[model samples]
Target: MREELLISRRGFMLAGGAALAAAARAGGGPAAGGVPNVVLCMTDDQGWGDVSYNGLKAIRTPALDAMAAAGLRFNRFYAGAPLCSPTRGSVLTGRHPNRYGCFMPGSPIRAQEMTIAQALRRAGYRTGHFGKWHLNGVSGPGKPIAADDPLSPGKMGFDEWLSVSNYFDTDWTFSRKGELEKHVGDGSDVIVAEALKFIAAAVREGRPFLAVIWFGSPHSPHKPLPEDQKAAGGSAYYGELVAVDRAMGRLRSELRALGVADNTLVWFNSDNGATPAGSNGPLRGHKATLWEGGIRVPGIIEWPAGIRKPATTDVPACTSDIYPTVLELAKVTVPNQITPLDGLSLVPLIEGRMERRAAPIAFWHNPARAGGQLNTATGHAALCDNRYKLHRLPDGNWQLYDLVEDISEKRDLAAEKPEIVQQMKTELLRWIDSVAASYRGEDYRRAGIPFAPATRPAGPATAPAARPRRQQRQQARRRRQ
Candidate 1:
């Protein structure tokens, strides 16, 4: 029965892909209407209050503030997960990271997943990834990936790339199309410099391009240039962010100089919430938890051709939405149903038709080792709509918050609204079950694609376990302290 079910699903996917291809041929893709160039820029470990425009008094992000003033700004944008790798995977696949077994940082995305770059390239766009590429597992910072590494950006459908395995600092060594190359100056400046080269070449040839620039600054071991450091008022972390802000100013200016700024779609956000050096605004918790502070970050989109007037929306959005949103805007179709997508296209929202999100967003994070194997019985999960949020902790305790009324999550309303809590909990559990099924290899058994095991080997099965309620309460108390 299981084998038969897999075959049936695969058949449906193939038929779907064929239909999409037929539609593309009938419409001639985005070229018929002139596709706008796409540029996706994400910072590492920056926070909701990191940008000067978002009310960060200490750090000045003039470039970001200007972009927000000139384009569509998102007031409630979120990362797919609380960590780096999982959120990055969501940006590419339009699906929750747990669906593909990318449960934590350093976990490798499975080879079978189809990425946004692959889909865009199929639609006649030159795809390039510059800066950090942490979807592939790396041992440490500044290490080179082997040419044969299955998870390299090239294999993931990038035509050209200058990337690092993890966070890199100034004068760091990076892999350029699989060759090690040393670069000087700040890491953010270096990556953007390389990306501009690729973009310039694409423009010279008159080709629409999709450039993914993932910055490595402000993550950890904060190192900033002398001038930027001095400007940061003695804080190395804040200094690093200053350099990122300067880099953004340079990128936007270069886009105008190249005459593509009008037609280019520049979208900016962070991979996760703030580090200790940064602030999450009025929200609770930090980078590793499911609190608003950990997952919510700054989001902005600038496209002079599409958005004539600047505006800001409070409709909740996430990194997973990037893939579907780009595809819809470019008129590109996914050749197949790669997996169950957790994101919805924000075209309607961008056009000012959507007042609220039709679908809720979910996040999951299981406590796992660096090798990606689940270690404890502990995990974190949450579900959110426009107003309310439901959080499920490892000890089977539930907490509910009205995000609109209390963004800080200082009040818990689980007891006051049991009916709403039960309804949300039911839905959250059902989604969790589906994700578990996908994690067990049910989603990859298409007719032609072989199933690949997760990067971390599973340990022997253990009976379901939960910490005692008393101990759980103590841990929660400690967290509060």
Candidate 2:
């Protein structure tokens, strides 16, 4: 890929809107009109390359393609974690899932953390959640959630909800505001249709809305409509995606029809990486790993009134940023936000004032390893520092990749760049310590606390060699005391 093509979109936004970008830096207006109506749409297991805009020719995603063409496409967007539940936690709270003990797909989010929905509701925005909601500590097939379920969406700040426990397909049953309702038809389409009804009500009431439409298509049990499957030439996975695209098309169109398209900030992305039957394009690794493919997925933001122009960016972003970004956009602050949030607002980026991410993104899988001290001998952990990616392996070794040159990560640059490895490793380990502290509720209710690096004696900050990395880190903590 040409370097120019990879970055031309960002170039256009930066160059064309220099004044707007400058004004934004001056705390100028995405607030000029009032904050936008927000819509968050996420798909289950959609790959980074699933959409035609990213280069899938087998199945056409006209709706998604249109949205991509008319919005800010994220060339390097990522899921907060490789699994669904954890990434969902990050999106709602703007913190790493491990900070609240949401390690795997069925892990529950802690009650102490503040969610975007809750904050938006406090801001007077109508809040609703539709489709698969797995953060309620439930497993197995998708089922109706009881209103009394402590972890239901109603309990988490959404005023209204039509959701289930996990993945759902056509003819699915949903719990609408905690009432068991069996909905017939394509599940993707069904959820969007329900969301539109909510959106229409909000529009009629002259209120802004935060409608979260998390789709259950393309995950498994590919039961796409016959016409959609036929359109994909008999590929069930692609067919499911085809339906997802159609659902999004209708969503955008309906927003336009309601005369709210320009002011509605619509975000489209995926819960995690692609499944085996799907593709992640050139990215390596699959769902449940720390590689680009596992965490990276299709992402786009379309707010016609707020965006200076349609563009794309290579800057690395993830689901964790959603909470802070939306909050900042609405100018709402969480008074009791869990401390040490892993994300920052993307309003600057949206306004074209951000050329690069301000901080590196840290990703770790299997929080059980993060119990007392980080156990590196199991699961995966990696950090993305702009163009460079670092993985601290289970065997207590480091692997590095210059993503700009090698997106597939076929080569390790750790041997050649020892200094960079040492510096990033120090920061990564320090971050791990902070996360562990949060896990133990050390930072609970201490909203807005900044992430601080461990003030270790310089030479001892990074994990030592000889002993396993995890064990040595525990030993270092004991020695410090």
Candidate 3:
């Protein structure tokens, strides 16, 4: 549990201006293939400060830094959760990982939830996933996914996938649609190459594509290529990053050579916070905490046909925003779509019409999921409502911070801002209940898992609104009387 803290500080950020502000909520602009191609790229354990554009001097990230300079960069980007599997699930589902019982690494994504890949593929977009796929409930060293594995990407919506169980280093093995294949090269380079082939085929076929490239590098075992390791002054972590940057450069080059660069939107970010070998910049905490460092990651979106100039926004965003954003951009509306998505479309944000993020990003991690009950009171939960962050401690107490003034989370403003705390707390509780409902199979329509309409307004799941405690108490007393 946590308690009240105080805060009062001021911070300055960059001003932004861009061209081509579109009014269309869907189909951002005309693309080469009628709809823009999507390339979603994510790295493992890389931090917010891991990029040169973020003021990092430890390693070179020219490719990623260039992307930030050419497109829209997010100053306050977050992973859905502080770990790999949970955040990955957020990207695919546009919902909090807890909503689908994907609370931690190696957690199996429930079959009932619809994925972005599934929604897009149904709309005739070729979908493919490459590299790390820990959502199948497998762990240990990266291994080729099994054909019979019900949770494989093939079963989860992707038409083709060259994936592994978890993180893979150099010269690793993968399941190319369940067929074993070995690759020799830097891990990042290897996956990007595979993804490029997928993209090329989609382009030749004149089909818009959704390529989910999850790179398994700089996570653990610190295995970098000999040349890359030497180039990094013998630090394997930085070495892995070198290969990552080069691989990204190659991907972009191939996109241009294929004449799809202008319309292809490449969204780049990390799964979670940095390890000890990486940097979270000035933020506090690491890897698994609810702090800014653990959840905040480097986010960049490069859409040449849409975003014409380099711009940056301090508006807070999360990985959950990916699914809805992609779907809207592609104009792919799912039939009987799942309601109350935790993500909001960032199309406006990319078009420069968005001044502030509309909804708060809810990060939920309740790992007591394998047979054990979800202990929201003792598990982790946090709400990033614009400039403020409210963390629910394991002991069921609360801690609030003004992230604008205190980026390091040094101040706790819960005591000073009781009204704000109460309001955000109400929203958090409402959101938690919604996630719990989804966890109980209420959102799933099936024989065993009955589809039940939501009885109450899940206010906090989309927008931040408060029903006062005093009024609630009065209503309760009247009901009792």
The global C-alpha lDDT for each of the candidates, from Candidate 1 onward, is 0.81, 0.80, 0.80
Better of 2 and 3 by TM-score: 3
Q: Per-residue lDDT of 249-279 in model 2, one digit per residue for the tens? A: 8788777766778889999999988988898
**Candidate 3 segments exceeding 4 Å error:** 1-33, 367-373, 446-481
Deviation in angstroms for 260 in model 2? 0.5
TM-score of structure candidate 3? 0.86
Name the TM-score of candidate 1: 0.86
Where's the lowest-lDDT run of ten residues in candidate 2? 455-464
Clashes of 1: 0
lDDT of candidate 3? Answer: 0.80
Better of 2 and 3 by lDDT: 2
Order the candidates by lDDT, highest first — what do you get?
1, 2, 3
